[model samples]
Target: MAAFTDATRVRSDGEGGFEADLDPLWTVGGKPNGGYLLAILARAAVEAAGTQPHPMSASAVYLSPPDPGPAAVTVEVLRAGRSASQVRARLSQKDRTCVEALFTLGTLAAAGDPRWIDSTPPPVAAEADLLPTPSEAPGTGLRIDMLDQFEQRIDWQAVGDPAGELRGWLRLPDGVGWDPVSLLFAADAFPPATFTLGSNGWTPTLELTVYVRALPAPGPLRVRQRARLLTESLVDQVCEIWDADGHVVAQATQLAAYRMAG
Candidate 1:
């Protein structure tokens, strides 16, 4: 497996075009994870901006799942401002578009503290009480290769509950600390919140939006994800990631299409 930085790296082709080889280890059920693809696009967008270094917000729509191999990225700078830059990016393979995203890039600094706070990272069992997130879905042979790239502990007890919520901890492997770009991956690294409702089928993300609030402190990250609503074939999930120091670092929401396993 490649390092997260190396796996998401993109090289400039000198004309708003970037070349990247999507790593296979970032795939879930043979398709590249939506967040991983977003990270790749964010990296390219940052590089294209040439001034802004962080992706503050990214809204993406997944069109098709591309294979784990070479892909092309094209970025168009929409507006470059003194404090922020906006860009539109697309990832394509075999002449077909896979993911399209719009990103706002800027340098993020800690804003002292929140004046009014409401959302907090949900409490979970102690590390000793949680179970290691399985590499494969329970009772299914489908491989979640993405788990190999990080450390995640899941509260199985909560997974069995009727509530559509999951609490866990995650950290990058190989001592690679978390950065703004990496936080994009962290937002979607956990198992889908719908799993708590006993639906383990593949949930392909139709759209995902992530906001990077601040840089994470050194240590493992605590994560909480919940499904807000699940219709007959579509579900919406929200995820919040807090750094070890309990500061909210990132938040994300996604809508996905799913079907119950027989």
Candidate 2:
């Protein structure tokens, strides 16, 4: 029922770059949150591409822990075409890169193909029905409260049992728009184990990536996650995201460097 008070504010830093002030509301484990950085990265891409008749797809990488102050964003116009544009957005602190995003904007005029296809959505417990979510338990792994900000739900089995896979649904903040940009937001919260592993003490995102297939229509969002210990010290999370009708929406793969306990 509450809204995020510290929404990001974008401004020009001259030389064609932008900056977003980091506030307390966008935090994970009491530190700056990944969603905040991702949101700013996507916003930079949209601004650099200018306004389009249609939405866009964006992918980002988290390079380092962001400071608790203002974040400098650099946007580059990689390419421009009649129907699409490519732009790169980088978030930096102290002249070093903290995060980066690559995005594509599509031009549409609302006067083209009008065909439609119906598909089945992933099966989930009814909204009125009950569903399981992650909880805080002693050591073993991390616990998440997805219900706090997003509507998506992750069962305790995914983490408490540490099975090889993760399964759940993702939803937008109660009143957000249902566009490709919304898809970008839905896909942004995953590869959660980066913090899970770090939770043993503290670890920050080293890098994050998300791929887009097809944006889901407005409704409940679903996510299925599975991870493999690629090396003795590295973990790769392979993810599948679906819409409420069980239709596959997107897939993502991310690698996280484990942090030692503090």
Question: After best superposition, candidate 2 residue 251: deviation in angstroms?
Answer: 2.4
List model 1 lDDT by residue over 123-237, tens digit each: 8777667766767856767898888778889877766454888888887877777889899988888888876686876889999999998888877888888899889999999
- Best candidate, lDDT-wise? 1
CA-RMSD of model 1: 1.8
Candidate 1 residues lying further than 4 Å off, grouped into runs, are: 160-162
Error (Å) of candidate 1 at residue 100 is: 0.2
Each model's lDDT: 0.87, 0.59
Worst 10 residues of 1 by lDDT: 110-119
Minimum summed lDDT over a 10-residue window in model 2 is located at 108-117
Against the true structure, candidate 2 reaches a TM-score of 0.73
